[model samples]
Target: MMAADETSARLTAVLDKVRALGPTLRERALEAERAGRHSDETIADIDATGAFEIGSPAEFGGYEFSVRQQLDVVTEVAKWDGSCGWTVWAGASTNWIPAGSGARVVEEVYKPEWVGPRVAGSSHFPASRGRAKRVEGGWQLSGGPWTFGSDALWAPFTNLGCIADDGEGPYLVGAQVPLGELRFLDDWHVAGMRATGSVSCKLAADELFVPDHRCVDFRDITGGNLDNGLKGSLWQAPSLGWSFSLMAGMSIGIAQGALERFLERSAGRPIRGTTYKNQLEAPLTHLMLAEFHSKVQSATLMTRANAEETDRLGVLAAAGTPADPDYMQRFSARVLVETAYAAKWCAEAVELLQRNSGSTAIMDFEPIQRAWRDARVVTLHGALNLEALSENYGRLMAGVQPHNFAGITTLDRFAPTAPNKAV
Candidate 1:
């Protein structure tokens, strides 16, 4: 592992670089949205910052930074451009999943010269209208119409999720395929996060052969099967907790950006209908801004605490002392619930600021409006469904384990526990 001081220095340097690019990212945000993807210059500039390597395996020229480090980088980037931050987050999220797939899989995914994220994935099986069949050497995968292929445009490989049965029963599996082998659909049209280029992806051929080395069990990915000989304290981190932290960072950053923009644009502006010559002087303006600031501060604190705890547990695991299974489960459940709340608070803050920014704030060129849209779309994510997470947390608090994985955490529940019942 890199020395702690060295890691901290590197993180500070990278953050400084990203902060320097703030104006450029903000300048290109509107253009990225209009073009349905980030500009080449924008991508290259971010790649230059080495932000994408935050979650990749350190053995493969990656940073392998802690979850908090990753969060800070992502939040800083997001404060300037939500889409760029989101793309980096998606890349970071995908790297850790396959980093433990085995040496061969890791080697194949992370090339020495890869400038962007080593991999981008569209592995949400529930949204995948496809299949996988167990073949002689590996699996013959046929899946498609996988939605939300974030950061796929610049990644060298894309991970595809499928349901496969190997005699005993069915299971969720992810296959790493070269980007060239996958076909992308131009279906990314959306109200927000348009620049993420989260288009749908499909197999270019009817079925493709993916050797066993290129595939991993979804259960293993979620459960942290680091016995693959990889040596990073981060590899032992809670998978769901780490992933949710990225989203929370992005949410808080966007809200913070919106607040900054509101303050900038509202300066010395007339109240229009009121006698106040400067809206900033209005008592209502102070109230709204204070509430927004308070909410963002609260979300930031919760997210940081979650990230720190994740890192602490990871370090313990790396030292060969694993957290108790029950405690880990409860910790993961709490992280999920807290993440949802953070996203909610951030979204509300952005909306509050946007609504008070006046009718001109809705213009496409206004950063505040974009932040509002991006924050809303983020909150609408399936995994961040506040109600469901709240219910599960409640159940856990009441001494009842979660009935389903819900993509939050997977612990020994790989196969179907009961016969499939028609919904």
Candidate 2:
């Protein structure tokens, strides 16, 4: 891996490139939304800019940029279009699977180019369904359909979330299965973020061989502590910590876009039957706009602050510097909590923006309406479930079992990533 600064600069360059393509991406948004798949032209444009592999580590032609970078880039793209932003997130996030697998594994997946997998963090465990069986070199996997396989269609592989029964107890693990071995069910019709093309994926009794190296033991990679066998600063945050930051970026960007549309529409627009000439001149309008601005600004600040802390801790871990272990534990918990807050404020802001948008927002073609829907849908991601993460953080503070702390898949009803440490 090259020096961290060089890689981060390259990642930033690509993000800037993506931002420059906003007009093209914006033009393709409705088409992608209607098709429930990103347009080939949009995909090609994203590919040309290196946005798809932004999450890749230094080992494989990737930047492995910090949490703040990831979130910033995703948010920048989402500011113009949500579907494209989501596709970027899905492609970049899939690298997490290979990052945990190891360097060689990542090389194989993106060797010639950056075609990669569509990973689902949550799924019906293979062992739970009796579909994973011990084989000579490794385990053979077969399973029924699983829903919410986001960004699977364009990818050639699938990261199947599973629980491996080690006889003593079941361990949370992830299996990288070939896409050729899995069947994709075309059923992604939805109201918002329709461009994600998140549909159900199915695998029949056709068992596929998966080598031991392709499996990621969640406990081993928790707190973003990926053992890449290198001194370079890449892919080494407590497990999945960066993901929340990226989600926060998307949440905030969507709300900001909605606000922009609101402002544009309200410039000289008037309220019905009111003595006030324009919404901009009315006291209630001033209050509403101020409320939206405050909520979104606060969300952006908090999420970015979390990103900075994440970067500090990640850099320390990568350099083999001694970091305060207590801080790391509490940091991850707080990042999740902050991430949920960001999502909450984004949703609230969007809802208000849409409400004040008047009858025009109901025109189906209005950007604010779609932004409202997109914000709501993205916040529903298991990782961003506000109430659940808040409670988990509280439990962690009380020195109690903070749910999903590993032990069994059944331990936490809603944890998307395995805990960095056992409770």
Candidate 3:
């Protein structure tokens, strides 16, 4: 078991490192967005932090910290720069899969470099077709076009969901394939988050081999077959909870960064014909700051509470006394929705500050402008799609069958098209 001091020290060290690199990373993100691609150095820094290692098992040299800590790291990084935080956090979150094909495949990817794994996934399953047919030694996979495969540039492995036409029913599967065998399409052109390097990719092999061990039936993960002991206690207690709570931290961090810039720019800057010496004394400015602070604090608390609950459940699950699957599902749904809502709130704060910051906020080279755009873009990620997630949570609360067990339908929608051509 890791001592309290050990965990605290580790978290602090990572946060410090992230903060130290924030300015450089922020600049790189802006450049990538403008240039339509990320630099190799930016990718290397992400790998070096071992931020991707947060989700792997300790046996594999990962910190294997609770979900809350992972969230915190992501949130904090996002504050410095949204795209980097998004890439890093998303990469780490992919490690949350149960120990089976998903975990094994990821482990295989990380085994060689230990520099963190690369991840690019989209919940929009219907948009692509990739499939694995049962075969000798390994399964054969073929498909084309998956979206949001961030971190694909350096990642040696990638995962795609497929469906098998089992005589009984359509069975869903997630296939892990070596990055070397896949083809990337240049399609990720957008106004924001261009640095994520998200593009369409095709995986075609005359029978790409996926060893049996690396193949995991999606049913197993959704069925809740994973059972571990240590995770429960660490995640259960409220005081010790808030590990996954870091996601909100990222939003807060972004808001904080913007707020700082606004303050610096607005202070002593007079509006024409105004009696006030500077914008700082403006009544509207005071109200904006107050609202921003209040919203940030509220979001932080909600994030903390959800993180605590997630931890508590982990402890229970680890103790061999897993919580009711339905309850767990509900909890997860709520947290996911709330986190997105918090992000929205944070984004609003940024917008407010930007609106009041005058023309300075729109300067392409200004970090405040970049932060605003990045937060706005990231809020649109399918994972953060608030309405769908809220409805999912409502179903759980009302004892209605969930649309998808994984809490995100983006992946499940692709099941039907997995066998034939890529969608």
Candidate 4:
């Protein structure tokens, strides 16, 4: 293993690359989405930078960097374009789960390099259904159209969920399928995150075959027994917390971009009527800008602190110390909900800025308008909903314990504060 200093330096280098590419990538994102084309070049640049490898296990050719580093990369990329950061962050995050019984299948999908572990599954509302039958060597997966699997264009590996029929229960099983094995449907036309190329995909259930090694019992990870190094490292410290923290970072970045555009446009052009010289001189504009800056700063600080805490926890976990499961779950849920709140905060900031900026801000191609749409869409992600998440955390805190999505149900109480409030 490399020295800690070396690892830090490597992470810094990756962040620098992401920062340098921010402007170009952001521009590319706008162009690609506007032109209705795939973001092939942007995706390639991310892959080449090894940004995705930050979350993989070192044993599997990854940097195994701290979760903070991962968030740093995602946040910086997000400053340029929300969809690019979202796509990269989502793909990287998915690899944290152990390969389980499907190790070989994962290996096959991620062969030669660990840069892109494509996960083409969608978490759209109203989940879809699948059929799984036990067969000789493995299981046969038959599924029609799965949304978001269209992202497989950039992913070498894909996951298809199906209902299992062992009579034990109906369970969702993830299988690693080569991109070549799936067909993409041209159905990902959307208002936001359009560049994600997240189209519907059709997998032939009858012809689909998964070997035992490529099939993992998703339940195994609930016990924390999978072989991915992150299970023992800081990356897995708060589990869900890291995802929430990253989401917060993305929201902050989007807000920051919107704020910058607001300031620039306000300086150049004033509202048509009764304004002193420029919009900047308008008291209302000044107040709204101040509020925007304050909230974005607050969100950015919370995101950073949350990521650092997660990193600390990961290091402790890697050292053979386990975090309190309940504490970790609450922490995770809190950060995710906080991220949504931050997105809402940013959306509110943008609304104030837009209202003051006049009719031109509503132009279809305006950056402020796009930022508004993106933030609105981001707030809808399951991870960021505050009320439900708080209830989950509250249940654990109140000792009314229940199984988290991971199936671990141990409660460890920690002080409650604002979502992503520094521990």
Candidate 5:
């Protein structure tokens, strides 16, 4: 392991590279949204920052930075542009998946000479998922046009999910397939996050062969059990924990960026029908800004705390002292609930600022409006919805059974016994 001081220095250097792109990311925010994807120039600019390597294995030439450091980088990128930050989240978070598939698959996926991100991934939404059947040496994958294939266009490979039957019943499996074997659709139209290019995709044929080594049980990925023989704290962390934790940073960045732009645009502007010549001079404006500022700060604190705990658990796991089942369930629950809350708070903050920005703020060219839309979309994500997550957390706190699967509401082995004893 590197010394603490060296790690900090390396993190700072990576941050500096991404920080310098803030202006460029902000400048292109509108263009990317209009194009329904990032421009080639913008994509190359971000790739050059080395930010996407934060979650990859260091053995494969990736930085594999700690959870906290990775969150910091994502938050900073988001402060410039939501789409750019989101793209980083997709690329960086999925890089860890190949690690769990073991060495043979990892070797093929994480080539040292790869110039940009190594992978993109499909969303967990079941409606757009595909199907697979176990076959000799691999699975025959079919029935896709997987929706929400984020960052797939530029990635070398995409880890796609499919429903597979193992005799008794059906289960989800993830297969890492080369980008060339799939087709992307231009169907990402939406009210927010329009530039993420999270479009639908399908196999080039009715059946594409995915070698068994490249496919893994979805459970192992979330449990942090897919080992590629790396000895880093990051590889030991739960995949969902790292993914949602870093995603919370995007919410923070978008909220922070919206506030910055609001202040800049409101400087000398009047409250049209009010007596104040400048909105900043109004007491109401002061109160509104303070409220959102508090929300953003609170959300950031929650996100950072969860990230630290994730790293601590990873360290323990690496040392052969994995967290107890009950504790692991609680940790997983906290990460999920906290992530949802952060999304809620950040989205609310942006919405409040957008509302107070007056009529002109709704113009197509206004970045604050874009931030507002993007923030809303983040909250609306199925996995990150505040109401659904809050209900699950409340159930856990009340000792009621969770309504969803383990790793989402609780870890499988650690699910509380006597769930109905509380109610």
Candidate 6:
């Protein structure tokens, strides 16, 4: 482990890197959005900051920054460009392969070192796309065109979902496969988050062979039952649950961006049909700004709360005591609820600002408009939707397991899996 001061210094450097890159990233935001992909320069700039390697193991030359640090950087980047933030999170997604059943394979994947390669993964509900047949040397993987294949264009290997061909006890399995084996569908067309390049792709069912070394039973990954090598490691912390905090951080940034733009654009502008020459002169505008400020402040508090909890749990995991199931549920639920609510708050805050700013601010090309769109789109993520999250948390309290979630038909639908212990 890094000494406390060293970790602080490294985190500060990374935060500074993102802060310095903000202007350039924001300058090129529209260009990346129109192209539906990050420019090579943009990706390189962010990667240079080590934002993508935040969760990597220390042995592999990774900084192994804490979850709080990861979310801090994520929030900072998203403030500049929404897609860039999502892509950075995707870049770090490989850090969570959950070492138990696939420990050897994961070790082999990172054997060469952890500097540049992009790692992408997919996990969808019900295992509808693929089949896994146990072969002599490994599993024969057939069928996939997995959705949510973020960073697919740059990633060399993508962990794909498949179901083992057991007669009565078929199980879900994950196999890391070469991106070349899959064909893309060019989908990801959305209102906001347009630059994410999150398109659907196809993998031939049963055509590709996955050696046993590259496979992990979804159950093992979910339960954090990895090899001894990772018993007391930060990587043992479940990655899926962190998705909430990741999204929460992004929400905080998007809201912050919107609020900044709102203040900049509103203060000097004249309000029509009013005696006031500028928005800042109006008592109502002062009230409006105060309320919006309060909203962002509250949302940011929740966002920081999620990040702190993640750090606490990570420390426990690193100390050889995995997080308790109930605590995980509360944290996970908080992530979903807080991120979604924060994103929604940001979306509405911008909408209110946009409305009060008069006709000129209504232009489609406006930055506040962009922030509004981005926040709205971010809140639409399956894991970040406020309604679904509230219901899930409520159901958890009512004794229904999240495994029985409406969209989830099976237990392994989500992985780096969590325990099914009573909530």
lDDT to native, each model: 0.81, 0.70, 0.65, 0.65, 0.81, 0.70
Instruction: TM-score each candidate.
Output: 0.94, 0.88, 0.85, 0.86, 0.94, 0.88
Model 2 collision count: 6
Per-residue lDDT for 168-284 in model 4, tens only? Answer: 756555566667777877776777767667777777434687776565554553334555422436434665565567767777777777777777787857567675777777787
| Tens digit per residue, CA lDDT, model 2, 1-423 | 656678667877887897789867777777788888886667778777777766665555566676777777788788888877777777665455666766555665666564433343336343333245557787776664666777666675666766666688776566666667677778888889998878877774466778877666655544344555434444665544567777788888888767777888898887887887688788998898889889989988988887777677667776778355544556667778887888888889999888887888977678888888888888787556678678867876776556654421222323433344522
Q: Which ten residues in a row have the lowest lDDT in candidate 6?
A: 406-415
In candidate 3, which residue ranges exceed 4 Å CA deviation? 102-107, 116-127, 204-207, 224-249, 395-423
Give the per-residue lDDT digits (tens) of candidate 6, residues 1-423.
788799899999998999999878878888777887777777778879888777666765667777777788888888887778778776664457524445575565555543343577676445448777888998888777678877776666777777775787767777877767777777777788777787777774438887887776766666656562543346655565455667667767877776677778777777888888878789998888787888777877887777777777777777767666665665666567777788787677767777786777656556667777877887777666577677776766675655454222232233334434632
Comparing candidate 2 with candidate 3, which one achieves the higher TM-score?
Answer: 2
Off by over 4 Å in 5: 123-128, 406-423
Q: How many clashes show up in model 4?
A: 9
Q: Which is superior by TM-score, 3 or 5?
A: 5
On the 0 to 100 scale, the lDDT of residue 345 in model 2 is 88
Query: Model 2 lDDT vs. the true structure?
Result: 0.70
Which portions of model 4 miss their true places by more than 4 Å?
35-37, 98-106, 109-111, 114-120, 123-126, 204-206, 229-235, 397-399, 402-423
lDDT of 5: 0.81
